[model samples]
Target: METTKWLLDPAHSELTFKIKHLMISNVSGAFKNFSAKAETEGMDFSKANINLTAEMNSISTNNEQRDAHLRNSDFFEVEKFPQLKFTSTQIEQTDDESFNLHGNLTMKGITKPVKLTMEFNGIMKDPYGQEKAGFLVSGKINRSDWGINMNVALETGGLMLGEDVRIQCEVQFVRQGINVPVEV
Candidate 1:
């Protein structure tokens, strides 16, 4: 078996997150700049070496003021911590399509273990003759764990923002280097 490297197709991949706001509704946002890679032996990605990084300054929530605030010390503090990163330590296959991806996530200079449930969406050959792999990833983490401890209390009683942030990713990887047939 030979190892093949994979690069993320940024145009076809997205990293998004959601958090409860005002204790009533959820606010959705996405990072506009991010990249990931994987090195795999054949097509069974369970043992792949995966890494991901996202630019904290590229966060977008549709509102410029809020986006700026998120980049400040109250949240990500992009000036001091410019990137959020994840490196997979283990991949546990739960089924043909499902997996538990164990990794360490670094945000705002804090690194913590996180497990993301992922679904392999299979592979395909695009019209451009490139082999592509798809995946759906989801996870949750407490914002406070990353040192983001800024929030206000609502006049009605509840807090301004939820502590738990739900992350979702629709990612696609394009095969790089020499093409090698994966054995069954």
Candidate 2:
């Protein structure tokens, strides 16, 4: 068996999240700058070591005002905590194509263990003859767990924002030694 490395294909990957707003609607946001990498033994993802990081300053919700608020001290505090990171601790295969990814997510200087579901989309050779792997990862976390406790009290007897944040990411990775030209 040989050790294989995979680098994130940033141009083909995205990290997005959804949160309830005003207890009625969902607000969507994404981190424009992020990266991930994986190391596996002979392409066995079950034994892979994965790491990921996202630039806090790249967080965007489409609306500048809301985005700015999220970056302030009331939320992520991008100035003090410039990046959020995750390092996989364990991976348990649940089915033929699905697995439970356990890792420690660090944000706002706080670290917490989290479990996420990962769907392995298999590996294929691209038009450029490069080996690429895809995955869909998703999970939910409480905003307050990372000390992001900012919220408004709606006069209607409900909180403005929900504590639960739904994370969804579609990521693609290119095997090391593959010369695939990527825009970003």
Candidate 3:
């Protein structure tokens, strides 16, 4: 069997997360520098092996000071662990278009199991004659599970940040081959 390689189209992909802040509101952020790649036997991405990486220092929450603190020792510790990575270990097709992606997520020098629910939005040929595929991914993980416990209590009798973080990504992939669809 021949495998096809797919590379992420950074301009068409986004990695974002939301966490509770001040015990009342949610703070959203994104990682500006990230990359992903996948290898599969064909257009059937249900069994694709996916690998992704994001630069910890590229985290942006729209606030310079908060972003800086997130990269500091209390949070991501970018100087010591600069990259967050995920590599798929197993992928199960829950339906024709939906899948459960089981993978190992590494952050701040710790690796943990993670499962992402993904929706495969099908493949298409752009006007430029490029073959592209789209996917919507979502998952949640506890920040403390990765040693990111920056516990700061507020005067209002609650914590400053939430423990669980919601992660979401919209990724578009460009096939390495021509516009022709691969046979599974």
TM-score of each: 0.95, 0.97, 0.95
- Number of backbone collisions per candidate: 0, 0, 0
Q: What are the runs in model 3 whose C-alpha is more than 4 Å off? A: 179-184
Every candidate's lDDT: 0.93, 0.95, 0.93
Better of 1 and 3 by TM-score: 1
- Candidate 1's C-alpha runs over 4 A off are 178-184
**C-alpha-based local distance difference test score of model 2:** 0.95
Q: Model 3, range 1-184, lDDT digits (tens) per residue?
A: 7899999989899999999988899999999999999999877798899999999999999999999989999899999999999999999999989999999999999999999999999999877777889999999999999998888898879898999999999999999977554332
The lDDT of model 3 is: 0.93
Question: Which pairs of residues have clashing backbones in candidate 2?
Answer: none
lDDT (tens digit, per residue) of candidate 1 on 1-184: 9888998989899999999999889999999999999999987798999999999999999999999999988888899999999999999999999999999999988999999999999999886677999999999999999899899988899899999999999999989874555422
Q: Which residue runs does candidate 2 get wrong by more than 4 Å?
A: 179-184
- In model 1, what are the clashing residue pairs, if there are any? none
lDDT of 1 at 112: 98
